[model samples]
Target: MSFDGEQYPGVMAPPQKAQGFRLNHTMLRVKDPEKSLAFYTGIFGMRVLRRLDFEEMGFSLYFLARLDDDEAIPEEVGERTVWTFQQRGLLELTHNWGTEDQDDFAYHDGNSEPQGFGHICFSVPDLEAAIAWFDSNEVSYVKRPEQGKMKDVAFIKDVDGYWIEIVQASKMEGAGR
Candidate 1:
């Protein structure tokens, strides 16, 4: 949908013209690959669509996706690498080798002083059930529903301390039956 700031009778005005570009993925650096992988693939049910290791660079890239049965995921590594870039919404996790051993290792979550980046959200069919699942898996929560002003919303923290907001799909804006 291209919008040149033209107004439609039943639609809201676009703030600016869209450039028709798609978001491929959001990258996050992880320290412990095993822990991060377990959290994303085991607990969250996301499949590792692609895994690329640069041995000389001392880092690896893992692309994950929440795919359905109808979707086509490549089997061969070369085709998978090309296919991974084609999807719009995928999570890219970069594991820098040897970083997990540093005693003072940490990454700025962008929520502290001079805050900039916020959180990534996931809409669930049942927010309560999702919260329970997270709890069952011993995942840490940044903000629970009952503790926030927005009682219907909740936030959980990933292993690297990145926030993930959880919202009820049926209750969220623009969601319908």
Candidate 2:
């Protein structure tokens, strides 16, 4: 008698697979949400997607997106406008009110040398061009592209002293040669 797979009663059922999740956003606690927002929006060219004020919690949250174009919309719908560039990713800025002692608060101290949790990274099309732009703007950078195992990595700091890592994906393969 031929044994069919379905006819075998002793066979156990297959295990279920878990669903995958994608990265949504990274949240950072800022000393001043307004100031942080201005740096990211003004210098980095990010747009405010949404802003929520939690008076009860004494905290405010602002969602920002990096947009390609710098066009301004009407004041009425400006806040709700969805910038095209942020569709790729987003940055979430959180501000807690009534917190006077920021010294004890956990925040990225740009004053200190680059150590653990160095900076946020962004992939760029042209590394040389980006570096040139940084030079023209008088922005200081470490210029260590791909130190150690991580190649094609460049470091720069924003106006607020937050470190930024610029990476060129294409050059990563031949990096450190």
Candidate 3:
């Protein structure tokens, strides 16, 4: 499979070698921890798996994951840290303590002039239902499911202006790069 980073225009699966490697997480530099945390946790239903603070660097990292079962997450710090790294496809939010106070603080969203990174994708069980829920919650959608050529694919923007693709698990084919 040739993954080319274009939803519906490339292979959805990664190469065989990629199978041996797991994507632990994607880190996003957030401006406001409160807003970013609320958006992901409230809308995406991702729970905080771990939190790391660097006082010297004046920054913090929040690891989040989507839980499907009642499996209790490790409570101990060391156990949770180990378990957090074992999970695949987790989201990490990095908050620089002073960014919230900076008037011009902003991270490259990988969509404009210098696009270095692409959007993250989430596979939902029901595309229609998820879309309805997003609409009811007044979520900012860059592209709705039925609006583009790829009817089953959609894109929503996070609080920091990062794009997130939402697709139904049943329609996973042609929804990735």
Report RMSD (Å) for each prediction in the order shown.
Answer: 4.6, 9.6, 5.0
Q: Which regions of candidate 3 fall more than 4 Å away from where they truly are? A: 1-21, 173-177
TM-score of model 2 vs. true structure: 0.61
Model 3 residue 164 CA deviation in Å:
0.5
In terms of lDDT, which candidate is strongest?
3
What TM-score, over all chains together, does every model reach?
0.84, 0.61, 0.84
> Per the 3 Å backbone cut-off, how many clashing residue pairs does candidate 3 have?
0
RMSD of model 2, in Å?
Answer: 9.6
lDDT of 1 at 102: 86
Tens-digit lDDT track for model 3 on 31-108?
A: 999999999999989999899999999999999998887968989999999999999889999998989989898999
Which ten residues in a row are the worst by lDDT in model 3? 2-11
Cα deviation of 35, candidate 3, in Å: 0.4
lDDT of 1 at 139: 89
lDDT of residue 31 for candidate 2: 76
Clashing pairs in 3: none
Candidate 1 residue-wise lDDT, 107-135, digit = tens: 77889878977887877788889889988
